[model samples]
Target chain A: MIGIAAPLGYAAYLSFFQDRMIGGNVFVGFDNYRRALGDELFRAGLWRVLLFLLVQVPVMLGLALVAALAVDSGRLRKPGLFRIGIFVPYAVPAVVASLMWGYLYGDRFGLVGQIGDLLHVDMPDFLGSSWMLASIGNVVTWEYVGYNMLILYAALRTVPHELYEAAEMDGAGEFRKAWSIKLPAVRSALVLATVFSIIGTFQLFNEPNVMQSLAPGVISTSYTPNMYAYNLAFNGQQFNYSAAVAVVLGGVTAIVAYAVQIRSMRKEQGK
Target chain B: MSVNTPARRRPRRASNALTIAMGLMLLYALLPLIWLFMSSTKDSASLTSGFGLWFGHGFHLFDNIGDVLSYDDGIYLRWFGNTLLYAVVGAGGAAFLSTAAGYGLAKYRFRGRTALSAVVLGAIAIPGTALAVPTYLLFSKVGIVDTPWAVLLPSLVSPFGVYLMRVYAAEAVPDSMLEAARIDGSGEVRTFFTISLRLLAPGFVTVLLFALVATWNNYFLPLIVLSNPKWFPLTVGLNQWNSLATGAAGSGATTTNFYPLVITGSLLAIVPLVVAFLFLQRFWQSGLAAGSVKE
Candidate 1:
């Protein structure tokens, strides 16, 4: 508790003050917050990640939901092969996964480049500015889709056999059974995956950071809020302001996550 | 029951279309891994020339592994050993602490249980990277920068792990069992260690693996705390090698064509984790579902 609390408390304290060149770490209350709130790059970075979440979360979770349904449907042959296949990527570190995909995304000697030349076709640059966001999203989705599937599938497995038998005896087909039973049983898992995705999207650092080397100038120093704070502290040496960004981001994440929890809880209760 | 026909006895199953869709999902997941394995086999020249899915002219997988392991005074092996130490100590310690704390919260009603639970829940939602800079500030102020404790200390606290153990403890460990142990003149600590810990194995291993992966994949935390490459985990080290491979010259860069090394090194890094996931799938399957207990 001390380990987690002390730093957060320190960050809250630090967020209120600003370090100045001439003033020698003078306490300037609310100045840091004012600057961070109005900072365009920070806002842009947050918006970009929000956009990422909007697109990536559904695609990833939808695929996970489908995979969970298929595996739990009891007709898939060699389910282990599919289960392990989808789940294998979850084990790859984000750093390593990003690196592998970065290489694959490369246009020079990467697989895309090799294929493009072999067929003499023009290929859109994946690391280009327009596509970089989605490219990172793809890497993240690939890494986590299976892990989320397992979570949902685990939940699906817990749906009582009695419920299925009741549905089956009513002459419900497979799709009808899934529609009425499996989806409802795993509602909590879906919500959990959503909350996790929200957190992960806001904390987007590793994928973009790793690919920054590959894309060079395409990935600015402030591509995400976390990256922005990182740059503020390390490159710009604005630790006080960086602490402000951290606090603000943390506050936003907590509120949003809490909102998600409340909404899901209400929905579940209403059901 | 005797009137039921054989046609009606067969269970309804998923359609062929769903199975095909699942197969495609499997394909999408496996393509990059397949590419990675194929990339590792080729030497630097053949890596660029051949197709990514198939093996190249020379099977340089062993040679590449040897070089990756031996390059720069065998620093890859050093990083591997460092990752092992951090994963074992950090993850092992985290699992123990979380188990003890969670069990305490579940079995015994302490004065600050509500407050601690609130803090734990808040911590779970807090973005860890958000604390990175402040943590560096605190660590630097306390003069613990560039030390393993900087990473290990933070990794010791796992809110999710605690939550999982609390759920598993409540579900798996019966209060009557503890009552019997107490009647046998067992101390609370002794009874917990002897009785509740075994019942908590699945959750413990799940927490251990989570911590292990977090520490192993840690980049931003270590990147800020430690400036020395000597203490770099494979994630940071391979990244350093990656930037060195980016055709950026004059920063003491390695050869620009060291993609083979990077590819092979990445392959090496994920092998242990993949194996761990494969072996522990059953535990993690249940462990993940255990999270829904609170929900």
Candidate 2:
């Protein structure tokens, strides 16, 4: 409670007031929240992350699902190698992953630049403003797909072999068994991954923040909500407003995640 | 016999196709790492000039490693040690606390148990970053900001770890076993320590690994809370080095780039966790499955 709840309550309390240059800390009613809601930078960050959640979450999860099913199918050669090979990236820290990808995306000094040089073609800039979010998404998907795959694969492993045997006896094909038996068995795990991804998406900071130096012009301090709050409190000395932003972000995350869980539960019941 | 031959032949073809597809995915995953390895062996000049997917004219791997380990009064080594300390004490303590609390929640009926569980569940939903600013403010008031406590104290609380352990304990530890231990005159704590802890080992490892990775990969909390270079973890420190390399480090700009050192340090920073995962992945996967894949 001290670790989790106390700070949350404190942040909530802090959100209702403003820290000022001359007045010090003073109660401002809902003025801070009013500012947060009206803050263009905060809203833009939120919209960017929502777009990220929509596009990146599905791509990463879809890759994980396919990897899990492929591994569970027992048809791939050296499945363990494939599993571990893909999973090795999960062990790499996000800072390192971002740095590595940032280096790779550099049009002047990166691999893509060299490849473009060799081909005598103008390569698209991965770190350009238009493609920056996609580049970050690629890094995230690279780091997490294996972790999610492991979750789904572990769930797949728990499905009783007898069920598959029964299905086989009923003349079910590989695709059919996987579709009906395996997918349903892993629905809860899928939902868990989704919720985790949703939380991760809202908390998106490390990749973009670390890569900020590589593309300073493109990634402003308010690139993401967390980054915005950090910069607000630390850089702008707007602690109260930062707290309000944090609270709003936290509230949105909890609501979206809770909605996902509730919807998944309802769907499970309907089935 | 004809039907059997076609069925067998079809699966063989499918298997080959599946293998090829998995191979492609494997390449996609490994390419960056391979690039990291390949590029880290080059001198700074060759880093940009040489082909990134292959080696430079001469190998400078050892020189880069030496520079990374020894540069700036061996700050990289200090960050490595800091990361080690934070991950060990933070993750180890979290797993222990989670195990005890989870067992208590799973086995014992007490006042406010439901409330406590609900709080944990709610905490799990609230992204950690949201609380980070408040935590920093609270710590600042308490005079722990810019100190290791700022990082370590928050790191110790793993709500998901507690939740996972609760789920695992409810299934793995039997009330009958506790009853038997009590019949033999074991106190509640003794029964828990001596009996239930054994049953929860896999779950313990699972929570430990998760907490371990989280602490190791942690960046934002430390970045916000700690301003002292002496207290910086590898993630923050390496990012600092990266900025320096790119001539982006605020106000203290140096013309000398740290690309080789940064790349080499990154590779070194990841080695321990990668080795740990390679050795102990099965335990983590199985434990996670048991804890999470509940109906």
Candidate 3:
């Protein structure tokens, strides 16, 4: 009960001060929601995060799948070494990863710069406005690809060998067997990874937040919805408005994630 | 089943290609970490100009370590200590709570077990970052903001850990054994602590590792709740230094030396996680292998 008490009690107390926090003389029920909906930056932040969702999620998951497939095929002689090496980045704290990448993305003293000089072609400034999102996306993809690979690989191992044997008997090659048997078997795990990726997408904070300091010209205070909410509450001191934004962002995530779950569940049930 | 000789010969060629491709992919994954290790040894000037894959001037490594240790009155050491405290206490508490909840859900036919399990499943889908704002609001209202308790308390509720324990407990602990414990005049708590918990050792270790890593790498939540530098974990502290490094880089100050410190600090921060992974790798492998057999 104490587990429940701490959070619930805190939320209740915060709820009581919504009027004072917002600076509205009139008591407004869900007016903060109205304000949040009307906020341009909030909408832009949402769109930016959605854009990230569209691009990065698929790439990250695809990389993970390919890595998992490669590692799981028993073709890799040193599977344990490869697995540990791949998963090592996931264990690196996000802040450190961002810093390391931030340096790499630096124009003057970065590795890319040195390489660019050697090649006699200017490397794109990763922290610049045009490429910042892609730069952060690269870091995120690098960090998580292996983590998701481990999950999918673990799921892939659960697939029975008899299915592959049967496929082999049918004169199916490795690609055909993977497509016809392995992929379908790990479909649920893939869906789980997708849903996790989506939820994680919305909460993209650390990479961009840390990067903002590294490259302030590129990252805005409202780079992502979470960053927007953090700035609104902490910097702007508009706690009520921040809470409203947070609630809405949480709602969007929940609704989308729930829809994905239900749709996947229904698909599984139909199968 | 005997393979046909002609077709079997073709499969070997394809598998060889696949093996080479997999090896390359593993190399690609490890390249950045290798880069980090190499770069950490170099001076700032060499870090930019020298071969990125090779070491340059090992003098700066000791210098960087000393600088990192001495920075802002040795706050890095404080952050390290606080992180250890957080990981130990938070991971320990999370494991205990998760075990108790998981055991209850797995063994006892409670009224709301299904509902509780469903809630936990739903909670697993909700990212920890989503809950950060709500948790911050909740913590602030109770006047625990900027305190270690704010960070520690929230770290205790890992829904995934609970879910994992529940699933593992269901299979690993036999009901017959619990019945036997009951027959031997042991209390439920005694049975749980002695018999069931012992049986759940592998599961416990798995949960502990998960909780420890999650809490150790937890940057966003601490960033939100704690403004006090004293309470900042290594992630937050390092980020602050990175921000300061960015400012100094802009001004072209003598503090350019701090870049080495950040690199070395990052390298040091990675050690504990590597140690944890190494320590737990055997257990994780065996646990997953065991899981594979049952499935």
Which candidate has the top score in lDDT? 2
**Model 3: per-residue Cα lDDT at residue A232:** 81
Q: Ranking under DockQ, best-scoring first?
A: 2, 1, 3
Instruction: State model 1's lDDT.
Output: 0.86
Candidate 3 yields a Cα-based lDDT of 0.80
Model 2 steric clash pairs: none
**Candidate 3 residue-wise lDDT, A1-271, digit = tens:** 3454444344333333454635764445677788889999999999998999999999999988988888888666677787887888888899988988888888645777777888999898888999998998999998898878877787888777666666677788878878988887778778878888899899899999988887787789999999998898888887666766776787789888888878988987997
lDDT of 1 by residue, B116-211 (tens): 877877788999877899899999999988988887888888898887788788888999999999999999989988888999988888889888
Docking quality level of the chain pair in candidate 3: acceptable
RMSD in Å for all candidates: 2.4, 2.4, 3.3
Q: Candidate 2: where is the Cα deviation over 4 Å?
A: A117-121, B1-14, B251-256
Off by over 4 Å in 1: A115-121, B1-15, B248-254
Candidate 1 per-residue lDDT, tens place, A1-271, comes to 8888888889989888777768788788999989999999999999999899889999999999989888887778777788889988887888899999998989645787777878999878999999999999999999999989888888888877767666666777778988989888888878888998999889999999999989977999999999999999998999999999998998888788889989989987897
DockQ of each: 0.61, 0.64, 0.47
Instruction: State the lDDT of candidate 3 residue by residue for B138-178, as single tens digits.
Output: 77778999999998998898887787788788899999988
Rank order by TM-score, top first?
2, 1, 3
Give candidate 2's whole-model lDDT.
Answer: 0.90
DockQ: which is higher, 1 or 2?
A: 2
